[model samples]
Target: MLKFFSEEIDFKLPFPQKTSKWIKTISESEGYNIISLNYIFCTDDYLLEINKQYLDHDYYTDIITFDNSEEEGKIESDIYVSVDRVKENAETFGADFEVEMRRVLIHGLLHLMDYTDTSEELKLQMRAKEDECLLLF
Candidate 1:
């Protein structure tokens, strides 16, 4: 199952059913199944508070993923996305909001799939994976 929600924001994901299918396609292509994935959209402040409270970090990020996948080849997690940050990143990257938002959205699922970007090399790999997923999106 896949769901979308908002926290301290008024946002709607366009074509949610299509989004769910796209996510499922990515998961299956990578040899996994979706149990439940929730996308919670929020303002920067709300997400910042969550980051500080849960992660003990004092910096803002576009997305925060909570990995709750308890079984092998399954996905069960909550993905928090900062709308403000997404908009800013879109402008910075010279891409439209929809494109950037999709990138961030899949970025979370990629994390749950064991993709890491803690180093430059890994970041490149992550980006490549993201691009590959974007083509399916």
Candidate 2:
């Protein structure tokens, strides 16, 4: 089952229903049932610390996902998202805050599904999948 784990959140996001709907839809579409998901919404400072501690990076980002799955497909892990970054990106992208938040959520899910966005081509494909899943919601 898909679940959320808030660490240090400022405010609750709108469109939580839509987010859940898309996650379930995407999970099933990928031929996997979500055993559980831990979403930790926190400040940029918090996420930046996590990034440094876990990823060895010294920059701030929107989301970071940790995936744990066995060969038989049992999935578990924690996904950390920065609401501070999400708000800024929403403004920069000229999209609604909820929409941008969902985009971040989908980004993490895509990673869990073994999709990468490091290359231009891969990013394009990932964005396409994000768009397709967004439409489904």
Candidate 3:
């Protein structure tokens, strides 16, 4: 199952049903099944506190993912996104707000599929995968 939520923010995610279906399609294509997935939308400050309290990072970020799967091929997690950051990122990248937001959304799912962006090479690959997934939508 996939769900979208807003916490401490007045933003509503666009096309929740389509987004959830796309996420499920990506997960199944990557050989995993979704047990449960939640997307939490909030402001930059709200997400910054989560980053600090949980990740020990003081910087503001676009997304924070908490993976909760106890076994392989299963996904259960909470993904927090900053709508404030998404808007800025959209402008920074010259992309539409919804496009950038969906990228951030799927980026978290890609991580659960064993994709990492810790290095430059890995980041490139991750970006390619994200692009490919975006095209599928």
Candidate 4:
């Protein structure tokens, strides 16, 4: 299952049929099955507070993923995304809001799939994967 929630924001994403199809397609392509997922969309202020509290970053970011996957290779967790950051990044990346939002969503799921971008090389790889996934849209 996949769901979306909006907090401190008033926006609606694409319909669940398209969203679910995209998510499931990506998961299957990545060799994983998404048993469940929860996506929370919030403002920058809300996400910043979460970042400071849980990650101790004290900074702003587009998305933060909380993994609730019980086993080493399972899909079950909550994904938090900031609409404020997504809008800003979309402009910066020269893409529309919908496109950028999808990128962030994929990014969070990729993290759950054990993909990381802690380094330049890894970031490049992650970006490649993101681009590849975007082709499905």
Best-matching candidate per lDDT: 3
- Model 2 over residues 18-78: C-alpha lDDT tens digits? 6777787887788766777877899999999999999999999999999877643455768
Residue 57, model 4, lDDT: 98
C-alpha-based local distance difference test score of model 2: 0.84
Please, what are the lDDT tens digits per residue for candidate 4 over residues 1-137? 88888999997887657977898888988788888899999999999999999999999999999999987656998888999999999999899888899999999999999999999999999999999998888
Q: Assess the local accuracy of residue 14 in candidate 4 as a C-alpha lDDT between 0 and 100.
A: 72
Ten residues in sequence with the least summed lDDT for candidate 1? 13-22
> Which of the predicted structures, 1 or 3, would earn the higher lDDT when compared with the native?
3
Which candidate do you rate higher for lDDT, 2 or 3? 3
Find the candidate with the highest TM-score and give its number. 3
Full ranking by lDDT: 3, 1, 4, 2
1-137, model 1: which lDDT tens digit per residue?
Answer: 89999999999988788888999999988888999999999999999999999999999999999999999899999999999999999999899899899999999999988899999999999999999988887
In angstroms, the error of model 4 at 129 is 0.3
Which model, 2 or 4, shows the larger lDDT?
A: 4
TM-score to true structure, per model = 0.98, 0.92, 0.98, 0.95
Cα deviation of 104, candidate 4, in Å: 0.3
Ranking of all candidate structures by their TM-score, best first:
3, 1, 4, 2
Which portions of model 3 show Cα errors greater than 4 Å?
none
User: Candidate 2: worst 10 consecutive residues by lDDT?
Assistant: 68-77
lDDT of each candidate versus the true structure: 0.94, 0.84, 0.95, 0.91
